[model samples]
Target: MRILLTGSVVATCAFMLFTSGRTLAHDYKLGPLAINHPWSRATPGGSKTGSGYLRVANTGAEPDRLTGGSSPLAERITVHASSTDNEVARMRPVVGGLGLTPGQTVELKPGGAYHLMFEGLRAPLKANDKVPATLTFEKAGSVEVVFDVAAMGAGEGAAKHDGMAPGMHQNGPFQ
Candidate 1:
């Protein structure tokens, strides 16, 4: 029984070691701002276009706005919003910044107000792959976030937190 117990302990340690790094998803920190759960959809290899998502939280006493973003992996990054009107789904550029109130949270998910449009994808993103991006905020400066690729059509139900009602595009960025 001594040998068996030793083996079990070793096995458990190995499992934890392997899985520990897996849970450490990419994160970006800037002063009192933390961007969490950065994720994106895996696109076909060599595809020049893709999308990214994440959640932003401000732990400071002042408000902030996500002005824009950039990445070496893509030609350009733009903030976009998707909406459905008369059964039509449309996307448009968010001219103003995504507003963030002190101690508030904003989620960027699929088919809703928060979206990262990658114009020039350097490499096709595959499921389980990771992508790098630099998020720019008006008050918090810029921070790097690693976006984990999510399965296609996996974020269908993530649009209700910020009043992203069904069938309609969200109205402006959160403040």
Candidate 2:
């Protein structure tokens, strides 16, 4: 009985330690940018592209924009926006950047005013995995975040529509 009790305690401790380490391993902060609910989609092998989503809350009294971002996986990164026009969803790069008014939170969600354009991916993003991203803002500077990769075709129309996160349709890189 004593051996069994000891074994149970040891097992519980081991489990707690393992879980704690996993959580700590994934915890990262990106300066003033409080990244929340970041997610992405799985991509094919050799594919040079992927997308990321997150929310940014500006706790200051000034406005800002997500000007730029970078990652070792991408050759180029840009902020974009997509919307519906004439019943057709069109994507255009949001010139300048996404605006964040004072005390207003901007969502880098799907099918809305913000999208992360990853140009060159070093490896395929697997489902249920995490991808590292570095986001830059005009006033907030740069922040690093890990995007939890969801299934492909998962992030469709998450901003305006009721469906899953469809891809976005916005204009070119910022000027």
Q: Residue by residue across 1-175, what tens digits does model 1's lDDT show?
A: 3555588799877765664454344344688787755778878766788887777778899999888789888888888888889998898778877888999877777866667788888788787676778889998898877777766655744322223333322222332
**How would you encode candidate 2's per-residue C-alpha lDDT over 1-175 as one tens digit per residue?**
3555588799877766665544433333444444445667788888888877766666667788887678777776787787887899876677898787766666776666667777778788888776677778887787677677777877543222111122221111111
Q: Which lDDT values do the candidates have, in the order given?
A: 0.71, 0.65
**Candidate 2: C-alpha lDDT:** 0.65
| TM-score, prediction 1 | 0.72
RMSD of each: 8.4, 9.4
Error of 2 at 126 (Å): 1.7
TM-score to native of every candidate shown = 0.72, 0.67
Measured with C-alpha atoms, the lDDT of residue 138 in candidate 1 is 92
In model 1, the runs with Cα more than 4 Å from the true position are 1-20, 156-175
lDDT of 1 at 127: 77
